[model samples]
Target chain A: MSTTNAVELRNVVKRFGDIAAVDHVSLEIRDGEFFSLLGPSGCGKTTTLRMIAGFEYPSSGSIVIHGREMATIPPHRRPVNTVFQSYALFPHLTVAQNVAFGLEMQRRPKDEIAARVREALEQVRLSGFADRRPRQLSGGQQQRVALARALINQPEVLLLDEPLGALDQKLRKELQIELKSLQRRVGITFVFVTHDQEEALTMSDRIAVMSQGKVLQIGSPTEIYERPTCRFVADFIGETNFIAGKVIENGANAATIETPDGLRLRGLTPRPVRVGEPAVLSIRPEKALLLAPGDARAGHAFAIPARVELVSYIGSDTRITVRLNDQRTFDVWEQNTLSTLDRDAYWQPGEPAVLVCPPDNALVLTE
Target chain B: MTLNALERERQRRERRTLAALLTPGLLWLILFFALPLVIILVYSFMTNGPRGNIVWQFTLGNYVDLFTRSIYFNAYLRSIWISVLTTVICLVLGYPLALFIVRQPPRWRTVLLFLVLIPFWTNFLVRIYAWQIILANNGLINSALRSLGLPPLTLLNTEGATLLGLVYGELPFMVLPIYAALDRFDFTLMEAAADLGASKRRAFWRVMLPMTMPGVAAGSVLVFIPTIGQFVVSELLGGAKVDYLGNLIQRLFLRSNPPNWPLGSAMAMAMMLVLLALILIYFRTTTEEDR
Candidate 1:
């Protein structure tokens, strides 16, 4: 019922036969915000976007777009447009005709349609290629045409279903910035669906991470990556090293878990945990630092004495595998800040090191 | 210098290979098709003797006769009209049927396309005779009408029956090409059109029809070319009541007394020119769409 939201799905469920493709899901997408549904294939993200576009009707509950209920509406009647993953540009029409199609269907004046089509094509930077057929254009150019074709309508909400999934890495990166800025320029709410976590983290104002037809978490990129509340979100968002232990103490702000070796680990808990419950302490590889043994690094909550088993020097960071006291292999990423090729400057195998676990960086998560 | 010689030797081998691969098809066409067409073109201008023989004297009298005679002129018009009408009807009926088949599940699509091909298993002449049995005064339809206490109307040997037979025979040609086009068609374009605010009907006209036009042109050529030159349907179904170009050509060559082979050759050449024009137009339109 809130008009401020560009799109609202309230307990929506879409079932194909007896299996639920999209389980009961509720979401409120803020007007003029770039929201993304991030999930792997078959996670119901595309189905949810299709329901909002009115291509698929929900089996239960309601979908409201700009205060209008849209379960029974067809895609054409809905005040929204989708940039399909395949670009789906009409092969028969020229670029200009394709961009002008929505205006033509609205019965707009021919001169107006022509002007707007020119402006829209220019917006996509395809002004010089108006008369060319779609087959003649390159894939990136075709994708831009698809964007212009949808954006020319200026709908209440623009839905993009993995539009950049077909582009090469360089082009995807270029268009990611272009699309984010274009959303800002047009000031239209965009509901983007993508399986690429880095893409969602880079472009989305807020992301809803889905799995098995349910939204596991909905937060900004930093919030989802840094402070994941559940085990799935913690593991799915980034590379995380987990320590399985039973909860020894549950407090208001943090929880403590004891490993079988009687080593206690304390971490911030986003959700409440009951004492004596089995839980996992999730720590990202980048958050942990590796120091020489007996270094006594200040500001470190807990330091475990371990031996560096393997070391890999990537350009940005050096990934080190260290063995903990309980024989569990822990991954630690040390940023390569210094410019040096000296072999002595890096950690070598069998070097005894201390793995510093920061108090604020780790999260205690339960299933 | 050695590399240059090697490249030259490779090019010679390639040329020989190309000639070897093309020789059979080239020889077949020149002997069976090109030679007959040249003979037809040559005989179209030759004189016709009193006893069904080609005379040595070269003349343009057959061409002049074809242009001036009302029967040939009317037959040309009627044949063109019937062929065009049949192609149009096949297109209108076949597009929907092809779309229906394409929309089915993969298993059902195979089964439905099989059903379309099942009629081809029967002989074309037998199917035309089947149509005759269905359309005759004492045939299936008329017999049913008679049993219903209704008057048995004349259904056989009419233009409608002839048209029905032609369309029924040529409809598969139209449907198969359209089905192939629809199968290869990316249906996501329909969803794209819908997302662009086009109604389902508008989407079909703007996107579906134009995209599948190559198939339409191909099917039209396949149907029209054969239907225009066809004599059996009109001969058996129309009972020689209407004189089409095919029937006129047949009568001049074989059926008429002291048959006029030169006139028949002239008529066949004219029909070929008309079909050549149609095919040229078809190619022009399809290539323009590609551009």
Candidate 2:
């Protein structure tokens, strides 16, 4: 990723009559970057990607690819290609023909077309399967064919609309890694759209978290994971415990919040919080530790009382759900790193426990 | 070994059930259709009676005259010409309309498809007759032209009129099949093509046209077969100017001054041969991709 902007959208808005499928989205995708538009279905991530690919004309504003304005140009005239989620391999063409379609459209010679096709199929590791029909290939092979077809065009940017969405779990994971490495090898900017948060975090150099046709945050995986700007981002990206509170003391870098149950908690904030304003304290499950009474007093910043309601033994971690004194629930994820220790057996349901977290790790955000 | 034996017994019982289910349709076809075809084949070789009836005497003269007679041979050519024209015109007109209908919203698609089938609800002959009222020189169209002080166009009793009637009669066959193909068509392929640097026109030709070829072939066959042997449209619209294969066949069997049963049956057999040849040629020549 570099400072050079390969693709830029300027306050682009797209409306399907009354529904704004993409609303005032403006973001710059860096050169050679794997940028993701991540959100739930109908959250306008796909719509945003479509607008950039020129399949859709934005209702307002403009899109520029490689510094050229692309607002009125049709998809065919644009200098970008897309891998449709369905693979969309031409049913009439063999795998070789499908990959060579763009070059043939450009009027390349037969000799060059053959060489480039072989090279493209080689990149996707499908060199031997040239004559096979698209229907003759398995799902993963078809996906690779789609990728090869788009990449062979050598556009300034490549648009992928959830390309691995239709594959099985194991195949999807395998393709996720393959696709990321493939993007790096080609060094062409990739604008990937997916609703799967884990997939986005795993593959994207930067992610544009979206909801309801609006971009919520644009950041790296660690930034999005540890320092989310809002409660929605925190909850959507991973499991989070939202503790309802009101700001009792505002500060430049840190603030104190009074929980509804009368317990006071302090946490760091990137943005200033006004005193007496309603807020929510966001904390990740793994950050919240179950204390053995006096074990947390020397270092932990805050402590609250809770009764264990349930304990789930996940292989890598032990998850415990505890109900706070005022009936609000809290979740704690304890890593089962100690050999020969079954943590689920240690935490009895209905037993009283203390939940503690380091102050710097908690995120306090205004609702 | 016991499991294999049990599976074989299960397969035997399933075959018996399938045979029982197929018995009615197979019997109906053999008794009603096959028997009539066999009788017609036999009748073609027999001699005509003294009073325009079958005499059951073996003769080859009818078959000889079938090719030597110019009127009968010419009718077959004319039928081929008219059927080809009808198929082409129906395809040219129906494709865009079917493409338009498929793009409609799901709710509107149902309504448009229903509209495509609406003409079938009325009696077929009654609807054909209604075209007579509309296409006549003194019909509603010419009358409207006259009221506008425009010169009235000759709209009926010409080859153009016959062609128009055939095309109109077969249009729905073209539209419905193309529509069905477009209904199941994956539209995203068109987008993928465009993204691959194909212009809108190229994308449509390479992707949309080839993808919908099955529907086009089905619709063409539907329109072609029926119009080739049809006498009604030419009879009503041709006004004695057009004598198609069907008109010639009817004259042989039903409207002959003294019925030549063997000759008529020979003409019928010749027509069936032409029809069979056409279907074979069509299936052999078509370029649909094999699955």
Candidate 3:
């Protein structure tokens, strides 16, 4: 893939009267990368996508697509296409005609348009269904037709606004994988917008998690999940347990924090933490281990006494919820394997348990 | 078995009660609509007597009189031409207004649509008279023209005045249905067309216009059918020089010597038949287009 940026937003600001729907924000998406804008509803992710597609204009700043500033360009004049959330296929036209529409609009040769439409249909694996209208197709097929319509234009960038949100869970999962593969095969810059973090994590090469009209953090899935830069990112991308603590020692790569319950915990610090500063230590549920008493070691693990609050068996794994003396709850997963359990020995309610999570697994957030 | 038979008997009694409840409306239609149409059919065959009453002597004299005279044929042709013209003008003007209303923001769309209907709330005859005053020789239009340094032109008592009245009176009828159709129009289709590289104008013609055709058909029927039978506009504005089909039938029934009742009945029946044919054609074309 080329290292050049395909699309760039430079301090873009969009406002609806007094309300700033998209605040001053900037981002650059490299060509051929499948980038996702991940956020909850009303977070201005869709507005950002619309700005990129030229459906909306930024109140300030500039959007440059393929090195050209697109301030005065209309949607139809822009060399970018959008796959709308609703698919938005033309009900009156057959799939072939819909796919050929862009080519026809460009006034290409009739035979070339037909050939390109056939090729696009084949690329989306919808070759035989080209004769059917959008209403005649199932939801999945209709979505594919919409994709074909956009892709056939050969736009420099394709903007997708929650394209898989209308499908059921299973269909959404299937399409997520299919869409990722399609993006890879086409090797085009894709700017996808969705509120589902799992969907973004599964398909995106990079994700920009946004909230309240601002981007909190942007990184790869693993980096975002393991090392979230803020409390919101840690909480939004995955479930994280926040424990209030005060910094006791600040080192080059690690910091020692004293928890409220008089426990000193050591964690890796991506940034410097001053001694005596208050911080929040975030630990993922799966990172915590359920150990028998006396199995924990100092400096490597912090052991806490708790009681099992709830246990749910989810086929391949069991989730155990434990409550501390302060009444704070935390979840730990126990994989169901031959050595672990034989339909018995599962922790039930009121049972005492020890939760042991490694110190390095905890991430400290100061803000 | 007794309980089952009792339930069946109760259902039969309920059916009878439902039928009895519906009988009044059914009887009213038969009396007012069916009975009058039958009476008109009978009257179309009878001759006009010396005392301006139907003589009950069956003849085809009225039908023969319609074709044998040039004045009646001309009046019919002129009425058809006027109705066609009014329908065309309404379509051209109403389609854009309806489209504009539909494209407004949701809150403003309701307010604008209410404005469209507000003009219709007044009495129909009062509105027609208001138009007559405006189109008169010394009315607002001529005075405005004169003040603008343009020569005063006589507009009333002309075909233009008749058409102006027809268009004004029927504009709401045309706009409402077209507005309804355009209101329900799927805007996403337009975006899809644009994404496919269509210009704004091409998208409008290819997607927006075709989708709103049902409204056009409905508006045309609503405007054309009523304007064809309108005598008030032509009579009040046409200065008694023009003789549309409605004026002919009105004169024959209420003012002509010997009443000319049979000929009036024939003319009324012919007008009704033409309206029926237009309605049938509209329905057929609209249904086929939908498919």
i-RMS for every candidate: 0.8, 0.8, 1.3
Q: How big is the positional error of residue A208 in model 1, measured in Å on the Cα after superposition?
A: 0.4
Per-residue CA lDDT of model 2 for B34-101, tens digit only, reads 99888889989999887898897898878887778787778878888999999999999999999999
lDDT of candidate 1 at residue B31, scale 0 to 100? 100
TM-score, one value per model: 0.94, 0.91, 0.89
- Sorted on TM-score, best first, the list reads 1, 2, 3
Question: Residue B167 error for model 2, in Å?
Answer: 1.0
* DockQ-based ranking: 1, 2, 3
Please, what are the lDDT tens digits per residue for candidate 1 over residues A1-367?
3349999899999999998989999999999999999988999999999999888899998999888898778999899999999888887788999899999999999999999999999999999999998889988999999999999999999999999998899999999999999999999999999999999999999999998899988999999999888998888887999999999998897999998998889999998999999999999999998888768683457877899999998899899999988899999998889888896867989988888888788888998
Candidate 3 residue pairs in backbone clash = none
lDDT of 2 at B228: 87
Error of 2 at B163 (Å): 0.7
* C-alpha lDDT score of every prediction, in listed order: 0.92, 0.89, 0.87
True-vs-predicted CA distance for residue A360, candidate 3, Å: 3.3
In angstroms, how far off is A7's CA in candidate 1? 0.3
Question: Every model's Cα RMSD, please?
Answer: 2.4, 3.3, 3.3
Expressed between 0 and 1, the share of native interface contacts present in candidate 2 is 0.88
